[model samples]
Target: MFVLELGLIGLCVALLPLSYVWVKASDDKFRKLVWMTTFLTLDLVMFGGFTRLTDSGLGCPDWPGCYGTASPFVAHAQIAAAHAALPSGPVSMTKAWIEMIHRYFAMAIGVLIVAQTAIAWRARFKRLPLHVSPWWPTALLMLIGVQGAFGAWTVTMKLQPIIVTTHLLLGLALLGTLGWLAARLTPIPVYEPQISRYRFAAAVGLALLIVQIALGGWVSTNYAVLACTDFPTCNGQWIPPMDFAHGFHLWRALGMTADGDVITQDALVAIHWTHRTFAFAVIAYLVALALRLRGYESLRRPANSVLLVLAIQFATGLSNIVLQWPLPIAVAHNGGAAVLLLLVVMLNFRTASSRPGRAAVPTRDAAPA
Candidate 1:
């Protein structure tokens, strides 16, 4: 089984040659590869959310494959049996496909990261406009390896809430790492002017945004989105009876409270309510960060990015509650959270990319050119 799985991963890795050849003629090959990985990571996060939302997380019911087989081919008989037994349970033909596809995308990303690590070190000794620290890709390769471990645990642990939530957090962390590396290695932007004067504030926003994402992940993993079933106020009340102790317990079984009791309605309400309330504060702070960047020409693009994604995030979030947890909107809401995250990471990277000896990127003076 393990050998077959390794071959599957190798098959995905084989595609990297095509991508590398396409970028081989470029002046900066590693830079393009890192950006491509970032793009795919964003999509992976979205599709992973889709799998969770559609209840396909346990589709395969095993780590890395569907019933000990690579493409769901050999597992057909077992999957059909399970679905027939439960009828509407987690395992199904369509769902197994979703899970496997998500895994394939993940393997492709892993392969690219490995290739990136090799290229960065190899190119360090060659002529280039900028020098990339081998540590950047080296560290990224390590992080993604850990991420792959969590992916396996996510299945073996049967989607335990804490385990699953941590898995999601790690995925976002990987995205941030790639974005930061790309910004550092990008020859053109390495010497560009810092976009935000409020670097300290942006850093704060990034930290707090991470906290907000953790809360959001908790909401999703616990399947608590519709607990309130109304927007602006939960269940049409300013305050609802909630069990925070049970809701916030970090370690527990899938649907059981920390005390091993079946989780209560009040606990679910608490999980949903805390996430909703905290989101307002996070949204406001991010908007402030975006507004501060509006004055800088170099920062305007990311500033607008912050605004646009935040708007979509708010819309999708509200629609999730009002629209009764529609799959498309929920998945898009997850994607919106990720976009908002990457924009902020990019903003931070831009502000910090000005190397010490190389003077800060010059700002556009108000005087006419």
Candidate 2:
């Protein structure tokens, strides 16, 4: 019963953007829907980060609903009992609201993706000039379903570090895919033969970014951000003592070793240090890639976006360490990563679509009236 209610809520939330695109777009409604969905997915990713950072992940302690209800309001008595039992623990009215709101937003995004898939198939059946294949949204719909499953697991698994980290990765993956889809729908004029040469480099940069984000997610999920508490060096040592064996153990519960023993400070330090150290390499490679892409006028926008977001990421990341991980800066850091990923995905699409002899083609589908 709660599941159906939740689905209805999601549908209601999704109608706003769907109606906007349907009415105001006037043309290229499909493209507008894709871009709008991409924007909302980015927001969902950042809110997911906030949910994790604020320890609200287990606030509801149930899947797809708060205490098996569609909204947190009805679960107030249960939440109050839990909070009364452990005032500082994971379950609280505020945290429950935060967690449920995040879930609601995610469900809404799921609804939007379904609408996109339906419209794409409709366009295909009518043999419209839809520039991109309908299968793209179909794939996005499938990916979002997997992401929803992981969202449930992140709760059912008790916020296990690996599960939470994987959830973050999958969310970002969905965001990146939507970005790619948006790029495909909106054509850019690219004539540079040299741009295609950077495709491999762009791919490598994106791969490295994914790895770095995974490590960062590991750090966040494990609550290891403040383990080092220093800049340029961890814990005032050029080389800090670390327990990589325990820190990198994938299947263990949160803050515990593989043997079910409580994790040590060294393990936390290990997680934080690895994320910090690898960040330098990721930043350097991406900066160089952005500089290379800047030489081409057609690629300049995304290239500049990369550079700008990279700078914000560096600043926010450093602030996370030196400023003791303020919430705003931390959330901004997470958002910066999402934005950077979007830019890089766009760069990859542009480079791949623009070849030596071919000019970038716009979507062929005429706007449906």
Candidate 3:
């Protein structure tokens, strides 16, 4: 397994120079291209969420190569057989398509990261720093390798809740990391002196948001979203019966208790209820942070965007439950979370890069060009 993983890394390394050549060969900004790739990666993460939400993780029922082919077009017979055996289960042509699409996007992002790393190294050898840390690319490469392993486990382990939720968190971490790299590549104008003070708060907010997102992922992956199905009250009461022990059981297989018996409604309810309550904490912190960021000129746009995305997330989240997890709204809710993640990432990067205290003080104004 490790050897195959290294072989994939070698492939990524071999593609790095091509990114450099392509960037140098084009009139487009490298940073902008990176950001574009990052955006697509974010979309891929959302689609991955959709895949898991729809129980399509096993749609293809295979590994890196879907059903022993590059796409479902070549594996139609196999998919049909699996689907026919279990009409509402995880195998189907549609599911295979979704799974393959997710892989394609992952490969593209991996290619981009490899390219970025190569360009940085080349630029470094030329006695001009790429102005960005090569370690960022290296870290991305390593993280993706781990993500691939988790992806494999997600299928092999039959979508265990903890593994799936960790996969989701890993995707968010990559999004934020790429967003930070993109921000570093292209400078943002800073206008405030007190921006440094917000850095600590922003850091804390990001941490809290990550935890909340993890809980949400756990709830969704465990099929716990509709456990309660009521607002301001769970099943018509504030404190509904909950077997947190079973619900929080981390090592159990999907739809099964720790003892291997089928899971109960109370367990799902415990999972769903915990996520709902955590939502309150996440929203409150993000809203407060957004309001604080409004005081900074450079951060106002991202702050407003954060607020808007949160509002959309709230609405979509409710719609998912009220509508019994309709596919569209559920997908949108997932996408909204990705957008919020990127927005916060950008804001944090802006705040860090603009810290007057850390930036080199201007000794003299550059002579008029």
Candidate 4:
């Protein structure tokens, strides 16, 4: 019964991309489908941030289906009763809706990926105009499936900090994949000579960015945003006391330290301060990489994009501190990080033409399409 309900909801959500594809029938259907899926995935990433920020991660209290049914309306009595008991806990009606909406968006992405996989397989055998290999979409299908599983674990695990943060990371990883694929489909000309050093630089920048993201995720999962309460100095000191042992311990329940004790304020500060201090190194290296690329005219666009998103990320990061983590700014900060990750992914993929070990990168603007 539960599985059937999930399928029903998936079917309902699938109508969106289905209808759009029908209305805009064109030669580039596969590419269009990929791009549409990419666009929706971007929204999903932002909304996922919204869900977490709003504390709606456990709104449904179950996976795939809300309270053993497809919609919150059907579970109104259960949700209301849970709310009446706790009132300000994780089971409110509004939160239920937020969580369920996030699921619907996810289901829609799944359906689109399935369609993409099937179409790519058919096109491969039939020798269609979209003469790309089927394996690409198939790989995306696999990645999205894993992502969905983490989504389920996010609920069943009762929003464990590690699980929730992994879910967030996986979502961003999926966004990067979709963005990279879409960039491949929309090939741009490269008039400037490819530099091996630039590719290496971008790769380093991406690696550092991922590490910073992980640290940031750790801070968010532990609810340490307000731990510092000041800029440049945490707790009004250059470095307040921090219990790194308890803070970096990974396998504890939410709000609990490694030894099953309530996590201390100092531990929270440790988490927050670590992420805060690391931002300097991340920014310095990425900006340097971007500046290096600016010397090449063709790489200037993505290079500038990297710098721009970097500034937005830094501003939002500070706003979260000074502004007390306002919802709009917080969510946008999450989105900005995802965008930065996406930009770096594109930079790495597109610049592969110069990477010594990489296969020949695809480009449609060789002579100009």
Candidate 5:
């Protein structure tokens, strides 16, 4: 506890000086700082995926520290004991290092959010109306606290799949929130266009994709990626055996039956199969949306971003199965989910801001559609 407290305090102390220099740099420096923070948060999200993928989530077996130390150096003996006690268990020196690194990055992000909140509040009297409220960063700070609790539960609960999946989703949610806020801070003007009749459909599609992402997270957390192990087929058949009830038993232990026994093979298959089945729907919707948005110059970047992310997601998802769940591909698959979430959030933001006659389109005169 002392270690975690010290680390957090050090993070705050470090940020104050850096932020002072950044804010004093120029208006552009402020923008760059926000973007740098945002980018690092995105990287942090990816690193988080790496940690979870490697099953290092429980490395420290505690929150904000590894065996009561900020770094694994002092906790090395404790980690070795835990690892030797269970050779293939969750606690090892490597895993402890990964976990602590994640904590540090998370703390840094918290600092950035704090800095953003301060800047937003100060800018209110200094000509930046959008920065006046600071409500968004305030909300983010609260959400990060909740996320931290979930992180603790993730370890204490022994990596219960539901809690783990929720943690993953929350990270992506943070990414999306930051992305939207960053977009708002940019000089890009919002365009209120006469959206086509498919706006409702697009909204629906986006919502469904988000839901599908949750399902994917569930599948990953439960270690169900290899349950099926083949593309377009599960265990060499279109429909393999499944036990949805047992598979989705949310209250059960990680990879265990409701009775505290190890989970059955059928349950794993059930979880994996469900995600695979739903993915087709997600792909179709995204492809169609991408094709539709291709002709609209304003929507092109986001549209292409969606398509590119979808392709990367599909490839990485397949790679996870074909490569026997290699760490890189699995981590990439998780990162792709974050990327897609950000893209969808941006799409939502663009569509919302593009309401008819609400704001002028940015760069309208510079480029021809």
Candidate 6:
């Protein structure tokens, strides 16, 4: 009963965007829908970060529903009981609402993807010469399903560090994929054959970005953001004591070692230090890549976007340490990562799509009749 109600809530939330796209998009509705979905997905990823940071992950202490019910209102008694039992614990009215809102938003995104898949297949059956292939949305649908599974595991597994980190990775993966789909649907204005030369560099930059995001996720999941209270140098020393062995252990409870010992400060420092040091290398490589891409007219916009978001990421990341991990700054830092990933994925798509021998895909100027 609660499952059905939860689905209905998701449907209601999804209808807002679906109706807007249907009514407002005069042409290329499919493309508009995909882009809208991508935009909302980026929002969802950031909100997921908020949910985690607020300690609302276990707000309901269950999967898919709050206290086995649809709305947090229906589960208020249970939530109140838990909060009364432990006022500072993970369960509270506010946290429960936050968690449920996040869930509702995620389900709404899932519904939108389903609509994309359905509309795409319908066009395929009618033999419409759509700019994007139906298989792209189909693949997105599959990826979202895997993402949903990870979401469930993140709750059921008690926010185990690895599972939670993987959940974050999957969310970003979905965001990147949707960005790729949007790029495919909306054709680049100027196709410079030379743009293809940067394809390898863009790919390498994206790969490095993913690794850095994963490291960041590990730090967040383990609550290691403040392990080093200083920037450039950690804890007043350039080389801090760290326990890489316990910090990198994959299959342990949150803040626990494989041997059931409470995790040490050294382990937390290792997680934070590794993420921090590797960030320098990733940033340098990406900034260099963006600078190279900026010389080309066709790649200039996304390259500029990369540079802008990278600056925000750097600023917010520093503030996270210096400001003692304020919630809004932390959330912005996560959002900056998503925006950077989207920009890089767009850069990759532009470079690949402009290759010399490829069949000329429809540009915005040349829509299919």
Please give the lDDT score for candidate 5.
0.77
51-115 per-residue lDDT for model 5 (tens digits): 98888999899876777777788888898889999999989999888988887888778777777
Query: lDDT score of model 6?
Result: 0.90
Better model by TM-score, 2 or 3? 2
> RMSD for each model, in Å, please?
5.2, 1.3, 4.8, 3.1, 4.5, 1.9
Give me the displacement of residue 178 in model 4, in angstroms: 1.3
Against the reference, the lDDT scores of all candidates come to 0.82, 0.90, 0.77, 0.84, 0.77, 0.90
TM-score of each: 0.91, 0.97, 0.89, 0.93, 0.90, 0.97
Cand. 1 TM to true fold = 0.91
Using TM-score as the measure, name the better of candidate 1 and candidate 3: 1
lDDT, candidate 5, residue 310? Answer: 91
lDDT of 3: 0.77
lDDT of 4 by residue, 1-369 (tens): 866877768777887777786577365666677788887888899999899999999999998888988889999999999999999899999999999999988988988888888887776776665535678889989999899999999899888898888888888888888887777676555544465567777888899999999899999889999999999888799989999999988888999987789999999999999999999999999998888887776677888999999999999999999989999999999989988898888788667654555434343211101
Between the candidate structures 4 and 5, which one is better when assessed by TM-score? 4
Inter-residue clash pairs, candidate 5? 191-354, 192-354, 192-355
lDDT by residue (87-157, candidate 1, tens digit) is 98999999998998888888888878887777666656553323566678889889988998988988898
Alpha carbon lDDT of residue 155, candidate 3? 83
Residue 99's lDDT within candidate 1 is 92
Q: What TM-score does model 6 achieve against the real structure? A: 0.97
